[model samples]
Target chain A: MIPALGLLLGVIIGLALQPTVPLWLQPYLPIAVIAALDAVFGGVRAVLDGIFNDKVFVVSFLSNVLVAALIVFLGDKLGVGSQLSTGVVVVLGVRIFSNVASIRRHLFNA
Target chain B: MTQIPQTPEDGRDLDVQPSTRTAWRRLLRAASPRPTKGTLLAGVLAVALGFAIAVQVRQTSNAGLEGLREGDLVRLLDTVNQDNSRLSDEIVRLEVQRDELATSTDLEQARAAAQQRLDALGILAGTTPASGPGIVMTIRDPQAKYTAAMLLDALQELRDAGAEAVQINDGRVGASTWFADGASGAVTMDGRTLSRPFVITAIGDNNTLAAAMEIPGGVSETARRMGGDTTVLIRDTVDITALRPLSTPRYALPENQASPSK
Candidate 1:
């Protein structure tokens, strides 16, 4: 439930921030911010549920950012940045779908 | 607790079986819900956001395409006009050289040099010198709205037709030249602004080059589709001259001048 709420809030924030951001930073900001916030919310929830490790959370967050940046940088160098980003979005989309499905099961199972 | 039978015929064991079963079922249902509403809502929101982003991206791409097209059209016209002025200047210079050669004491050498220059110019213009075969191709926009790509295609066709040299609106054709738009969508080429009705000239075996250009799906066809006029004529002699030496190239050659020696 908390993850869902966080995702919704992140979407709203992204939509609002896109137009106000600088052109150079605009491409990276909305999606990055949303993903980071979503991860943070999930981490907090896990900690509350007594399943979180600070080390694991920190490592996952750092690796996620590093991988995303590396992919973007390599794509740009290869002249296929847009295509690579699209692929990343597609994978993120599948993950989001599965996450949402699990959240739904948690909220409405009776 | 022992089960107390309320009715013998009904077999009701409310004190034990029924209560235990109800509690267990309730606990099981509480542990697992069939549909999680939170997940459904999040999924829908994400999809909607993705759709919105896709629309915005498409709109931006369309705008860029239009910008590029406008830029190309403006550049093409400008290139033609700039070339015309350059050709006029070259013609003037050649005339002056001819006059000087005619009056000089070293008349024979000067005349020879002048003739050679004239011959070079003639070849560059797609004109025959004295008595040879050359083709003349005149290109103009019929509706006065031709694009840079169309002009480029025509130039490519001329080259493929075995043209030794080509000129447009009197400007010598070179690799560095390209059409681009300037302020307010005006066409500019090589810093010179130009208008429409671009004239192109080519020097070659007039008949052969003309035949090549006339091939099906060739430049002539493309020009026709673009509503541009193309006239190919075989001239007995045509005068063409090289334009003034090109300014410094945009990119410099590598500095390793002695690499081959090693």
Candidate 2:
């Protein structure tokens, strides 16, 4: 309940503020958001598994966003930024799908 | 039929099954797991994630150029640059024309040129009187020896001497002027008979015209041989005030017309 409320509040604040992204950070924001989504899904599956760890969740969330951004930054320097961004999104998407499937089974058993 | 399998097993299975409400409660319990310290942190992280996603989505939609590659962006910049330069060139050309018109010099120049052309045409068409330094010649023919042809020759000689305007006795020498002998054996110019001592007034360079009349075998010598005498006097200003009426063409048409009238 708290997490859901927090997400709603964040969305409201973002809409109200309408912050403009800087040029240097533009390429990394979307990649970081996808990585954070993957982390959230993994955390939800772990909670359903009865093996949720606060420390592990926090560390994984931060590291996922950072590593994703780093890889894209490196790709930009190597002239392959778009390709690397695609690769990262594809991998994270797969993970989110599998984790959501696990959560579904835990709840529905079907 | 053959003593259907009516064991009490079906009834026992129905009695052991949990109720729908309890099954739903159990699923809810399993789904929540244990709300631990991570819940608060997860809530905070969720906030950050949601905010970032919303902002990124907004930015992408707003600009729509964020996803383009560097090469595509460069090409777009090039196209814009070309358009900017072309428009600027057009603006510069229009500005030069505007400046020229604003100064009013072009208008004045055009008016002056048109006035000059009108004056020249008026003189050429003999619709205007002219005056300048020129010579006047008088022929004294007591025996009536000078014929119309001799007078015509003398007039042609004056024309060759660069005479701009000429008059014989009260008749204006125009493009259509003709000379003929009247029934009384006197020279008639353009149907007007001239009295003895014909006065010819011409507007031109005084020196050139005087020299032309005095040339050997010229009008003066021929006049002396015919029992007549000719005398020339140069003057600073001789006005040829005779003007010809404007004559409209009867058959000719301007070239720009589509067809001529029958």
Q: Per-residue lDDT tens digits of candidate 2, residues B1-262?
A: 1222222332432222333343345546534635667778877887998889888888888876765667779999999999999999999999886676566768886567678888777666677888889999998888888999999999999999998888888777878788998876688987878888988999888999999999999999989999989999999999888777778778877776747543
* C-alpha lDDT of residue A90 in model 2: 99
lDDT of 1 by residue, B217-254 (tens): 88777778777767887776654553634355467755
lDDT of candidate 2 vs native? 0.81
DockQ of each: 0.05, 0.25
- What are the per-residue Cα lDDT tens digits for candidate 2 across A2-85? 566778888888888899877888889999999998998887766565556778988999999999999999998898999999
User: How high is each candidate's TM-score?
Assistant: 0.32, 0.46
Cα error of candidate 1 at position A59, Å? 84
Report residue A103 deviation for candidate 1 (angstroms).
79
Q: Whole-model Cα lDDT per candidate?
A: 0.55, 0.81
